[model samples]
Target: MGYKLNIHDPQDPTSLPPSTRSRLASGRRASESIRVGIPLDYNIATLQPSVRNAWIRTLKALHANGHTLHPVRLPATQRALSAYYVLAPAEASSNLAKYDGVRFGSRAEGIDGTPESVLFAKTRGQGFGPEVQRRILLGAFSLSAQAIDNYFIQAQKVRRLVQQDFDKVFAKQNPLLDDIAETEGTGDKVDVLLCPTAPSTAPLLSKVEAQDPIQAYMNDVFTVPASLAGLPAISVPVPSATEDQNIENEEYTPFAGVGIQIIGQYGDDKLVLDYAKELQAVARDS
Candidate 1:
């Protein structure tokens, strides 16, 4: 969460642009007491036992540090995974269409016919990886006239719902919203939302390859929702000592440490960084 400028000049901070320097100075200060929302029912089934334990400990530490903790449920975030996959691929297909040998990206050698024929097919097949190709194809299908209403349009609606879910929980108003009516929700708004970064720790490469593609996408469940809402989010790692407390037993200890994600409202980037610094200290002590 904290970034030390690695430049040779120690006075680099002073040389920064006015806005950048102001943000840096603000981020360096400790955050005031603020309400943080913890989703009591979200992603419960998907999280690993160790990750759940670490997340709980992090929340306890924050509560002990005088930060108010509130329980909130964001059910719309559960649909973000599917919506993101559809929308992301559809956008990628449109953006990357130019990379078909005629424009940017690598071109294939000695292909017969026009750029739209064998050349395009061969170029994309050789240049793009299996996953990229899969997404591109899926995207193309989703955007097609026949499937647009069912897939692409539905995904767009889901994206809006996901954004609204975050906006509802955030105490700060989203500047992008036109009116105050957009922020209404059931519970008291919170300054930030805390959750696990992923369902579990980093997985082994072999295990990853052996799993189904859907299972692989499940790793992104916790992160995609924040992205859909365009919120400022940081994943701070829990200290190894705290995360590996059960090392003596044959339990699943996260060697790399679990990541606790803190997500703040849009334009709350500085606040997010400040909170992250405090959470990092809490993580070390816990």
Candidate 2:
């Protein structure tokens, strides 16, 4: 509901490269930049410096395009990431449990009725991928009587906190509370949140494959908070400043595909797409 446009002379802003976005915090023109909110507690340090610089350039480009940067922070990232690891696997375990040979899926022909348990085992063991199997085990353990309250139940509570964090940031006015008194949410509400799509730029396929299963999950750290809250988030790929600047990393070339995630408040699907389109168009024109 809060959308406005301003006209400014093209020559007024500095012609800095996209890479200067990080330094824009200290720049005099920063006051005129878009007020974008990056989430709080995200593991930004884990990202490679080049990747971080890539983000710097992208944000600076946006700033040059006449957007203001706002310091906004969403506080549920760590908790949501924790809850997601538990909850997603738990649901996957339950949902995949139905595929146990007899009721569903292909059955082993060699042993039919006598060794029913082995049949189920063989079917599942051969059917599901390694990661899926790992999740199933984790989920089963989490859902067990002793661990359920400690893991699954606590994860649910964290999920609610994740939702509340988003709602508060979006300045969601509760309909029920409105009858009693003004339940106006946060005073400084941003139209959308701009963040990194992943912790870093796209990693090499071979390097990604070599990562430990749990380590691979860390890629979703920045994403889980918004995802858990069921908000509409779009990862719009932007051209990297170092498109050909290959860093001397241990393995593989530098990631040239830099992605920026734009998230809208819950149910604001159109707003997310529209802004993404605008950003893409601007990038293309530039």
Model 2 C-alpha lDDT per residue in residues 171-283, reported as the tens digit of each score = 43322222344446544666567877887667777888888987788888878877787777998877655443666545435446667788777545566777787778755
Write down the lDDT of every candidate, Cα atoms only.
0.81, 0.69
TM-score of 2: 0.78
RMSD of each: 6.3, 12.3
Kindly state the number of residue pairs that clash in model 2: 12
Q: What is the TM-score of each candidate against the true structure?
A: 0.83, 0.78
Clashing pairs in 1: none
Candidate 1 lDDT, 201-266, residue by residue in tens: 777776777889888898889999999898889999985455356544333445658889999887
Q: Supply the TM-score for candidate 1.
A: 0.83
List candidate 1 stretches off by more than 4 Å: 1-29, 112-118, 181-187, 240-254
Predicted structure 1: lDDT:
0.81
